[model samples]
Target: MNESKFFWQACRLLWMSGILLVLISWGSDVPVSTAVSNISYATTITVDSSRDVSTSLSERCDTHTPCTLRRAIVQARLLAPAARPVLIQFDIPTSDVGYDASQELWELEVKSTTDPAVFRTVEGGQVTIDGTTQPHGRVDGPKIILVGPATGNKNGLIIGVNASGSHDNNIVRGLGFQNFKDHLTINSSHNTIEDNWFGLTSEGQQPYLRNDNPQDGSGSAGVVLISGAEQNLVQQNTFLAFDGVAIALRGNDNTVRHNQIGTNALGLLTLKQTSPSLLCTPEDWLGGGGISADGTGHLIEENIIAGLRQQIFAISTQPDAIWVQSTCTSCTIQNNQVGVDAEGHEVGVCGRGFYLTNTKQVQVIDNVLAETYHSALFLNGALYDANTLRGNIIRKSTPWLIPDDSPKGDDAILRFTGLPDPLEFFNPAKITHIEGTTVSGTAGDGSPCPNCVIELFLDDNDNINEALESVAVVTAKADGTWSATLPTPLADGFGLRTSSTTAQFNTIANISAGTTVGLSELYMPGYVGYLPLITR
Candidate 1:
């Protein structure tokens, strides 16, 4: 082809590709111009405390006029995607409702009228409800929102208004959430819940969840994250009496960092027994521990846990400060302080600092845990490479502390049994289903690796590394399986299908070229953690 002709052809190809990208973008609910328009007006709406108020439609909310917090949220939603973000700011040191702000401390309440009684709901992207407006707050000053030695509201702040902000930025910061059944329940991704207080009234009173089951200490859904919520920042928050499972996560890659969690209850929780994939309600969240987490690739770090158990004001079982399950793959719980000085200050009411189980490549490192009823760290049945458990400090509480020290068999730092070796290969499963020219699978142990990748290579030279002749790449389902069709369909053998995300014993399939694979011939790579053992 002539130079001029070739240049035009290349330009046409580029133009067509750009048009295709635009079409794909247009397929979504948001348009580029719409998002740009939203970038303009940073609408700051204010609320005057109106108790039990709600918004239906055509209700107006803005700084010029006064509206309830709920009504402001409704108005914000209406103005979003055009404004891109709508900030909800609390009025000065007081509200229209009788929230006596006599001492520079402002307060309000969101009582539950709904069946499960949620205080308020937040959704959408790029929305911020900042309570720190200099006078009301400071970067390094006293917290202004107070509960005045009285009680707080009844429910919690639900953060998934029908799955809004599932992929955008939504932030709630610097507010004191007190006496709610649970503090914050987040079911969206990339949201930030930080620099806030939970479980304490304005006057720094411990807010107790109406614990229905005191005997077992099971009640209240602390902070919850579910519905595939990923990469959220829950940081620098404080919790008072409403601990035992202060935060519950049922999602992937959500970060719980730099928060002051735990007062009289376990700090954080993540369970799969009742909660499952792509589903889990805040109501389904279980209580227990400062960090009771069960998921893949979560980073829990630098949080202070003072008392990882709910005293219940009665006889009850205490939980760990940090709890991890085996299903948690490559999760790191690190660099956290879990106790205080012996002057009636410390974490764990006879509870462990770390209780880990069924975890994969989990690291429990560099935590100072004291004043516990049991071992500081307890490990049971999980996959651990050199990456797990190092540089930790465990010591007994001083004399005259509550919960008489059981120094006999449980007051140690590290305890483990029946744990899986890092390189151990066990019951791993993968399933494949054909969808048009694409193939997908759910890949992992019994649990799921939600956003796992699968790669197919045409080179079946039996060299796992060298077979880089690219074919196709596919992602697994929420269940951790994967499938990908070859560049060309073969009957079966001589191709390779591998879980691109692998451990020491990564699962890779050696397809019989010219032969079609159905479910799979579960791979047994030489080395799973990184490179194949053979190559090494």
Candidate 2:
């Protein structure tokens, strides 16, 4: 391939790797060398202090002279164009005053201005602010904490603006950002934000509570990518406890994968601040949520979102684990676990799994959504075309199920106001029988559109589809008949259910009513003495 082709391919591969795997750790930083190989010049700037003070432009970030984060950022921006890129590492002492009285925490306090305190604009791209170089950066969570001021709106960092697209390929990794209006705002492209903790404490155990005035300084969000910011990769990060959205995407073609939005790093515990009196007032969280996408062509996959719910006094509006607005066209949200933990168990409180309103050409596939108090899949607003929901396991949580205030029938999927054809979007699939390994289903009992795919799942002792594992997948014939035999026979007394996905529109129907498997349903084989006989 040509050099340009090779470069683009390498970048694509790098993005895929970032989306699929944890790209960085405390021992190593994001591959600045490998990512920008074409760049001839580079420099390293080491920050030794956790202070937010600026340094002279002429000074170098080396030993003998103290280098602050603010100074390193400014110097990197100035040197970035000529140097091509700059690596900013940390070397702050654990005993510095920046550390708490217990000496277990280290933070840099940036006073909030009219807008948030932007450490630097990151003029030239390819700048890496890696906190993994700090003393306890090797720990499971972040070590360097960037704390906002007591009052006023504070923003942790901003990268580039729309006017100038020079800021690209910048990276912010292994840091803890708390109490910022929008922790990190990006307007540039090709940037990677990985392995960071937002709205959480340095240890990543719980939400950061502002001690100065508990009711004040609640941040609007953790990360906000402006409209101009496209093709950015936000992966392997933890977002929780923000007053509003955790990650708000207004850009196109960004990929948010493997991120823990509302869950801990292990994807087990919820990091939401439950107490209304201690933090901001109860009114702050009305309709607040996990992830909101208003951009087009974005890929949101492999995220664990729970935590969101109706806060105190917020009766009418409920939060969603993931919200896709009308502007987000041609987006794909797949393999995500909403209202459920990494182990597929219902863990946290979520109002809805997905709230898609007026979205166009969006695809929701292969996601597990459970334990939501409201509808698991809610589609409303203007008429949208070519939107699809296929193979998603959405069900109410059994045993630990939250009571649904507004019941939209027994099914957890809800559709209203300008939906597609009923068979394609509103109708539920039907399970005729589940005999032995073979399972049969109907798409609305042989509707006009009969060609579809059916998926069978072992229900969790109820009519609702709770289990994440699908037992069988079968293709429905043009006559609306579908059957699939599993590898092993299903046990008697077990409840089985199926869902349908239209071949034409690719829309999935609500899960069918649970049918109990019977003992007589097992396929019997004839045997002669000790020899087994196979019969059709």
Candidate 3:
């Protein structure tokens, strides 16, 4: 009985050993299938006549199937290699699949391979990349080219090129992207989007409907919805009739140069709100103000901004033209021409030139302002203490109306009323030399206030009271005239005194109960000085 039991135990152990061997062999063979699935051969599946065909990449290379354009893309992607670039060309236009304005014709999905950056997808579609359709997965590579008639149905292109890394050296060129409710989002950095046309014609409703929740329209944008991207460039593109904005930039250290942005509800709004949690707030919405910038260390130069309806208007009741809310510590806005209104009427308009708010250490120089309705440069609700405005030519800004006064073109310079006490009565009209260095002439309406006190204090320290002893107070005679000889040397170093100043003459008599006040001339040297009077 003991011998029989031992023999049965030995047989049981042998059966267990054979099962372990089978499991090991199966594990080793499974990788072979995985490797085969990842590697694909070069194959072309054409659809000359209309038919839907389903075939694997291996079978496609052996037998060319006549398939629809959408299915052919799936087959091509399935058989692509990790390192090699694949070129899929749709030569024929077939209507057998039916016209789907929602979905694009060839929707290819490039899955997350072993190394996505090494693989590229090149598509030349005869039809459009409609908004309702979903394209393939994220493709990683140095280059992604989509050429042909590609329209954003109401939605735009979802190019998820950068998942990791600081830079995405991707190139998207030669495609027509239009009518997208939302922006064609480019999440990657260091990319180039060039030679594209984006705009909208619909006025009744919003431009695009969102995918997750279809109730709201995506809000039209020209090209590239920039979020968290830096050091990227958008150039040489034409934008028209978008509801929200042409191009909105959220990231910093980026450059938007040499682009023609015009005739939309708004144009090129830039926001610098970097908080990820607060990205979708209403403050980020683009109404107008071509190319708004909120972040720091950004350069907005050399772009033509024309026909901007309200180039600078607030989303809420707040007023500003180019609203710079973020702390852009050191930025430069130079060599740009703003406010040549093609429509020729400026009402409810902001930033005819610029509206700066809560920003410091900015330099605005060498810009031309032509035919603007508001102030050529408006600084409101903020301190422009350390900022510099030099060499800017502001011409033809007339009929300045700011919800308060109806000042004509003669009241050209506009400044905030009620400043500090020492500079309190500082009129912008007094400082601005409109007729070039002659303050003794008649005012805008030819009526001269001859007794108007014009004080001009010089830079040098000179005692006019001690110099002219007997005639200390030099009072002007009639005919609105006053003249004073220099008690000290009238050379470069000496300046005029404030106390012993003279008054000018008056032409119109002040009618106080039908009585006339005598005319007098008041002259203060520093108050009526010309261009070379003050030195920086």
TM-score of each model, paired residue for residue: 0.58, 0.77, 0.45
The sequence of per-residue lDDT tens digits that candidate 2 reaches over residues 285-358 is 22235888998999887677765543434445555788899999889887787766555556544466788887
lDDT of candidates 1 onward, in order? 0.49, 0.62, 0.36
Q: What TM-score, to 2 decimals, does candidate 1 have?
A: 0.58
- lDDT of candidate 1 over 1-536, digit per residue (tens): 12222332332343223221121121222212221123333677766554534533344565324576667666766664667667776655344443444434555555445345343356566677766642443333123342211232345566666444443567776676645555677767777776566654344333434433322232354578875778777765666544447777667887776566654212332221222331112232222356678778888866667644454443445666777866677787766767542122433333666776655567664566655555566555533433344445444533222234432244232324354432233222343444334544455444334444454433233332222233555655555655566455533334333423332222322211111111123232232222132211
Alpha-carbon deviation at 262 in model 2, angstroms: 1.5
lDDT of 2 at 183: 82
lDDT tens digits, residue span 303-374, model 3: 555544321223332222244444554566665555432222212223345655545666665555544445
Show model 2 residue runs off by greater than 4 Å.
1-41, 54-65, 100-105, 135-138, 210-218, 270-288, 310-312, 342-345, 398-410, 417-429, 460-468, 505-536
Top lDDT hit? 2
Ranking by TM-score: 2, 1, 3
Clashes of 2: 0
